[model samples]
Target: MTHILMIEDDPLILGPTVRALTAQGFHVSQAMDGAAGVQHAIDDKPDLIILDILLPNLDGWEVCKAIRQRSTVPILMLTALSDEIDRILGLELGADDYLTKPFSMRELLARIKALLRRVEMDLQQGRQTDRVQVRDLVLDLGMRQVTKNGVELSLRYKEFELLSLLMFHAGQAVSRAEIFDQVWGTDWLGDMRTLDVHIRWLREKLEEDPSAPELIQTVRGVGYRFTAT
Candidate 1:
């Protein structure tokens, strides 16, 4: 069962969200304030977090930034703040997704399902011993580690998935649409620029020269190809 940590101040929302997640076979832990929520996340190491913005003691954005400093656990922010700037700030603070108040329960379920599906796929792939390497770069799926010149590379969640998929389909040029479907799910309607941002970050980490990447080549007008030979 996937365990979730939810931090919210509103008693009404807190109860309903927990009950809903529990019904979906998820074990949930609740924290009424940001400090406790961050602590619970550290103690429980939950599969994901559902955090509220109007939290007392620390507030959601600060909690998110602090938690991200310690772990790369997936974060989904729930906020009454509906402004685009507020949403983007949450994302920049290391949140995987942001949902505004008055959101449909069905949509909430769909988002959770998509995130769980993506994580499960990546976890399953990480447990397999078979791996693919290109030049000095090594991807040991079983160990869930990547290495370049025998030095382990620390990649964010999305970065790992992007590299893993590229290596899995070595020579094929994967289009942006295909990447979106594979990583973010087919139903996701977020802007495509999100993918580009991640790709740019991934290149900076994996490439000797991000400006002129070699192993992971960007085919103009098409997509990206990982040549691991």
Candidate 2:
């Protein structure tokens, strides 16, 4: 059974979520504060995490950052802060997905299933020829590792997938729609800014100057193109 850790402070939200998830047959672990959430994430290492942004003891951003420092566990952030900046910030802090409050339980379940499905697909792909080298950067798909100049990079799951897709089609302009369909899936209802955020993150890790990236170049009016340059 897939284990899920839910870090939510509100009984109104937590109670129903736990019940629903349990009914769906997922082994659930609960935490009522951000600090406990982080500790549970470390000690239990759940397959996926449902995190709330306005957490006590520590905010969701801090908890997400702390967890990312150690593991690449898929995190889905829940919050009432629905501003575009807040959503982007959550993704930047390494949350894999974000959900606003007043969301339907059906949508939540769908997102969880999608995230888990993506992980499984990635695992299966890892069993194939998994290593690809573009210039000095080396990506080992089987190992879910990326290294440049022999130094490993700390990339979130989406970041790694984005890099892999771009590198696989090096020198070709991959359209935004194509990227969304491939990386986030065809069912993705999130903001288009998600792609831009991941791209910036990739540049930060791979380029000598993210402000003037040479490897992952914007194709203006289209999408992005990756080059061995």
Candidate 3:
């Protein structure tokens, strides 16, 4: 049984959503507040988390940061706000995906399925002992950690995925479309800017100078290419 932790305060939304997910054969755990949500996430170790932005105690953002610091579990953030800043911030904070509130059961389920599918694919595809080294940066596939000059770098879930993909095909121009399909999945419903944002974040972490990046260079008409140093 796939365990899912949902942290949502509104009973009306939480109750129905939980029931609906249970009907789909998922073991659902519910939390009405952000603090309880974080606790459940840590103690229960769910396969996925559905977190709402507005909540009592710590907000969803804080809860996300807390969880990201410890675990790499996939997070699907639910928000009433549609601002671009909110979406970008959620991504930066380590959310795997975001869905706006007032969504139908069909849409919610689709998003959940897509995220779960991506997770399964990620787990099954990688080699157990694979390690990629480009210059001073080292990515350990088994451990899912990146180190620069022997120092590990803190990378969000998507950031690590994006970086790995780029480094795997170093010196090749990976098109934007190909990258979106590979990293975000073919069923991705997010904005195009999502990739650009992730790329920028990776550059900030991996590059010696983000303003003038030497590694992970942008192709004029294509996408990005990670130049092996």
Candidate 4:
């Protein structure tokens, strides 16, 4: 059974959510505060985490940073804050996905399943190729590491996946729709800005100059193309 750690303070929300996930055949673990959540993540090593922004002891952002420092376990952040900046901040801090409060259970389930599926797909693909080299950029798929010009680059989970997809289809124009469907899963209903942000992040790491990105070129009115040369 897939194990999930949920860090939510509100018992009202936590009780039902855990029960629902349990019914869906998931092994659920709970943490009422961010500090405990961080500990559970390190100790339990759950397959995925459902983290809330509002918590006692430590905030969700701190917990996220702590987890990212140690593990690459997929994270889905839940927040009552609707501001785009908050959402972007979470993404920048390495959250795989984010959802606002008042979200339906059905939508939440879809996102969870999508995130899990994406991880599984990545692992399966990793087994096929040990490494991929394009110009000065080298991707060690098995190690889930990337280096540009012999310098290792720190990439979040989504960023790594985005680069992997582009590299897999090097020199080909990959449509925005195809990328979203493949990376984030077809069930994702979130804004497309998520993809835009990830692309920018990839450029910053992969391109010598993010302003004049030559490695991952944006195709006008379409999506992006990865130029190996």
Question: Could you estimate the TM-score for every candidate?
Answer: 0.81, 0.94, 0.95, 0.93
Sorted by TM-score, highest first, which candidate order results? 3, 2, 4, 1
What is the lDDT for 140 in model 1?
72
For candidate 2, lDDT tens digit of each residue in 1-229?
Answer: 9999999999999999999999999999999999999999999999999999999999999999999999988899998997888999999999889899988999999999988877786666543467889999999887889999999988888899999999888889999999987888777766678899999999988899999999999999899999966
Better of 2 and 4 by TM-score: 2
The local distance difference test score of each candidate is 0.82, 0.90, 0.91, 0.90
Candidate 1: give the clashing pairs.
none
Pairs in clash, predicted candidate 4: none
Candidate 4 C-alpha lDDT tens digits along 148-198? 889899888888888988898889999999998878878676667899899
Q: What is the C-alpha RMSD of each candidate to the true structure, in Å?
A: 3.0, 1.6, 1.4, 1.7
TM-score between model 4 and native:
0.93
* Candidate 3 error regions (>4 Å): 127-129
**Candidate 2 C-alpha error for residue 145, in Å:** 2.2
lDDT of 1 at 135: 78
Kindly report which residue stretches of model 2 are placed more than 4 angstroms away from their true locations once superposed. 126-128
